[model samples]
Target: MHRSRKADAPRADRVGRAGSGALALLAIAATLAGCQRGSSETPTVPTTGPGGCPAVRAAAQAAVAQAERTDTAWDGPTTGPAAVSGRTVVFVAETMTNPGVAGVANGLREAARVVGWDLRVIDGAGSPAGIQAAMSEAVTLRPSGIVIGGFDPGSTAQQVADAAAAGIPLVGWHAVVAPGPSSRPPLFTNVTTRVEDVAGISAQWIIAHSGGRAGVVVFTDASVPFARTKSDLITAKLATCAGVRLLAYENIPIPDASSRTPREIASLLARFPDTWTHSVAINDLYFADAAPAFRAAGRKGTGPPFNIGAGDGDPSAFQRINSGQYQAATVPEPLTQQGWQIVDEFNRAFSHRPASGYVAPTHVSTAANSAGATTWDPPGYREAYRRIWGR
Candidate 1:
């Protein structure tokens, strides 16, 4: 679900099964706006009970309500070419190699093809200036619509507002506009997992597995909102688990693409001699170093060694989980689903019976199913999507 208010700010691991086309249909009905509740309030989900779908429905409603309240934009007047179907759709992102994000780009392309619309892609390499330049270039083409992944809204609010001003719908794919009180114009449409939701889920998992007894040493790439949000959420949630203690939640200052694993691992081993049962990670990207170090130091498994981790389902994370090198991980459906969902909404926005909003929640994948898993699969609505775009 989606919402309309904005606020303050912050901060994945794992894998799960591929979804079917019916997912899109289910989302449309389950995620109508106005159902989401406040961030702090977690609805009573059936922790242990039968017919849990009702509880799940309540939770889903709360999630949708939260999204609507948080990312509400001005609902600007419809813009763009009178005929949206033939207009080109362009997707812009921070980079293509980011596993979660790449899935989104692929989804948008596939959706575009399904709808018979033209598609173009641009990579910004995580550079603010590069992304700005890319957005500027994208606007010049006057495409029917645009989708963005992982660009900070505070920095690009004006550019996005300008796109909307031009009458082109600006849709946020995987990343929602930042959502603190200070966040800029909320994204028009987004497929996001609220930071708290991700953190709460992780904390619940950790606490359950560790019997509320665990120690933590966190590594965060402060640049990503989702990462920062997750970190903040974990810090708060862990405080409640009396048995769980956070040893350190500091940022690791590693240059982009730098190999800081050995140094980080060495520091962790040296600094936290007692060993933690779990080391929380924000994404698979950071595991390049953290995972190996945990294994090398003999910190993994059912007991003794701390469980190593790779946050999101980066391919390596899947491998690490399957091999028992890491304990567990969270894998959302590829960002492609986000892309496809946003496009589906965009298409509806063109029609009079457009949907008010929607949410695409993620699934968690563990070691048992992580072996040989692939994150990039076409949406289940491939045929329907293709029917709209064409073969």
Candidate 2:
């Protein structure tokens, strides 16, 4: 993902971002880049039968709404040696210029300090080559283990194989879902945010908030797994709404998000002319510039489409979520907590322990409940982890 704010800057109602010296090094090279798709065409997923699409869509959307307020159980290691003193661990992130990404890197560093492990991080600059080079450099050190932050597992296959051959346990954080393809070797452990769930949540929000009948434009990006995962899921979810239909899909590349999202959205709206009542974005950043476009496109009287975002809890996103106007709702990922989870997962894997790290708490914030909320990490989470790690 791309980040525009300083990682360490203060938030109006939240803790400052957790970024270390290593994150600063990667910020300069941080311009997100990713694989581009050939086209945006997508056929709606099939949903038919009695009570019809409207009934089904509403039911499904309601389910998501109920789950949004549900709490998830934390299943990661609670009591154990946090780190082996003098051991070295390396984290290679896609980019730290991103506030959430930088926070994750620092979270791992903070946990590493408790257990006394030497931690090193490399920025991949959001490219295959950058990931490979970072992996290579980490491998050269022959560290206790390696962690990949938000890079494709397939792209890092060779490097992963190399690290494994070198007796290093390779773990991933915020990259892939659990039980990843049998075809692709599973990382010793993958610390993840269930993006499918995130997508389902967003889709339902659009469905319920829009009254089960809406025209939506799904914005997807090829640079990150999340964009694809979310786009496909949301598209499928919307398909179940008999009254709802897809207007179009815009696949923006990472480098083009800031410059192209507005133009693409504008063009889509101009062509459709009030057909879309709401829109869905891969993340808040993807829809950051949409309000002006909505106004310029003459989206008055509520017939024009509004937008919703997922992941990366931008302060603005929360504020807008609470406003309930231009920005409807958003799913905020706990970036810092996930980072420390990576270190815990790594520590468990290094000790030849069982799989015990999974970040399982999340929330979707809307205008009604966004007030005074900042992060997804539960209160006393850091204290809980410390006690569990026996630090």
Candidate 3:
């Protein structure tokens, strides 16, 4: 969750694959159970690649289309001269402690290179005032745009509004709390992981593996506003599928899992003790710590109870999934990818061609599918990144 160092930018030789085709399809499918009805004016779809994956191409094209549709904060002098150059786009996060956020930052720097925008990321130290200071500095520096993915977007509306007042488009990702469901300022475009989509996919996976009925153990934080929102969503969606019951849900603030960890996990194991099961953890970080606890207590196997399902595509959880520890987990593409998309969309919006709507891609890695994968960093993105940044 820490800001990436300037020297750590992707190197010219460390290129990763650009699987927008697979990624796009994954994103679309993740976001929609079914495709949206095509408007009479719906644009043509892009052709597929050698993998015979059409969805990825379609998503890439859709991303481009999305870029075309959204408007930017700039109103005067559309193209007489570039609005800004060698400008920086700062990303302010809750705390720079998560690896997934780092991955996103890498992908974003690459994307910024494509659009000719430089990047400067900051950590919010998980505080409202810290985020405000970051935002204040960003405004003073006047970068082309700013990306804020605070732990609780609700806590920083005033600072965000202030950035808006300075004509900086504040781009927010996952877990955005809208000014209201229907109200959003032109200076902002909220982007998130599409929680319902992620939940639905995770649900589908659980239903398939668990035979439509499973007991769940939800690790949540009732005190944290964002976790509460997601915990509620996961709880309600579990009911959508038949036979799935929340056997027990523990809302222990993370790391504090020490006291409640053994007690609650042991309690759930005692109650449902079968290996054919589907459990849900808030994310990989928590899963990394707790999944093993479940396993140590003899909770891994196939039958009435099985391993828990973790979210957020966090890398550590992916490592566990690779080792045949967890059944499956979802990982967002390198945060660099999301950042790149933001830069692209920002430029488009600034140039008066904002995206209509877009979905960032995700990878659902299971033991069988993710084999031979050494790391999450793709192959071609690095080259693209180096080309953009001249690094």
Candidate 4:
């Protein structure tokens, strides 16, 4: 197990896709199973976008409906495996070095114990090769199921097939698409937020805040396919803004993100100067140094060029948002909540029950809510998963 980062201490710890249509509704219906849907009462959503982007405002308003699902309660398979008391569940973490990964593993460890399941977590070191090796080792154990955090589908196709062939149910957290119950994907299911939508949340905010005329400099991490998708969506959404301009769209693969982010921003600052209004990246980790770099370039303007990111919920990110400086909002996934949910997903698949994989309850933390929120876990969520298992 990797050492967990202290949320109150310092910063750093790095760490999605699409397909949310009819299958999405079915998945939501499955998770919310018996809960009643449909309500004309709409919740008031905050708008960080300027007054020009009605579309952005509408997107924010639409998020209110998801809140009705209320992911705090455990709504997984009620009759799963009678008791997963002796089942050895393998949790394949992308890397414990990252806070989000460590936090998720911690949640699963706690949840597994609560559910009386034997959990063996073979964590990675934040690399593609590391994930592949973990998957390879997991296959030999032939555990009841496997939960992959931050998985890349295209790369892990073979490993997933082998696990499925050997009768090991696989569930991914925030790395692949939910291929639906009928699609029969290599992985049984995926529990995640639509990363593209999460990133778009920030874009929507930017366009509104920018008065619908925004120039965005997008720095995409190409190392992960999910990150690529997020950046692609941000670019595409920004294009829809009435007076949008894409100043620059660069692929800063993880290998180069840390080393190149500041320079990339600095270069964009020099070249486009006033053309760029918002800066969106796959995650805030890439901007560990870029925030100061942005300030260093003396972008002392009014409120136009805001910095926003997804894969939100890191301590430093919240701090940046709270500071009301360069950061505007960071869209965060409820990682700890999803941690327990992943185990439940495996349980459902293991028992041959219809596994409607969950989409982690995600929300964007802006300056308005930074005081009330943190980046590690969802607010007001407790470990009540024991109830889901009828304990």
Q: If scored against the real structure, what TM-score would every candidate get?
A: 0.70, 0.79, 0.67, 0.76
Candidate 1 residue lDDT tens string, 114-225:
6677888887665677777778888888887777765555456667777878987766654442221111344556555544555555555555555556666555554454
Per-residue lDDT value at 353 in model 1: 37
Ten-residue stretch with the least lDDT total in model 1: 10-19
CA RMSD (A), model 2: 10.2
- Where does the lowest 10-residue lDDT sum fall in candidate 3? 38-47
After superposing candidate 2 on the true structure, give the runs of residues whose Cα lies further than 4 Å from its correct spot: 1-58, 70-83, 177-183, 223-226, 295-304, 322-325, 357-362
Per-residue CA lDDT of model 2 for 297-379, tens digit only, reads 66652334767776676666666666554677777777677767767667677677866645455477765555456555544
Q: What are the per-residue Cα lDDT tens digits for candidate 3 across 137-228?
A: 76678777777654444456676677777877777655342211113433345554554444444544554555455666656655554444
Candidate 3 to truth, TM: 0.67
Worst 10 residues of 2 by lDDT: 9-18
**Each candidate's lDDT (Cα)?**
0.52, 0.63, 0.50, 0.60
Query: What TM-score does structure 2 among the candidates reach?
Result: 0.79
What C-alpha lDDT does candidate 4 achieve relative to the native structure? 0.60
Tens digit of per-residue lDDT, candidate 4, span 236-331: 566554466666566665555567777776777777777667777777766565776777887652234687766746667777777766777677
Candidate 4 shows a clash count of 6
Query: Is 1 or 2 the stronger prediction by TM-score?
Result: 2
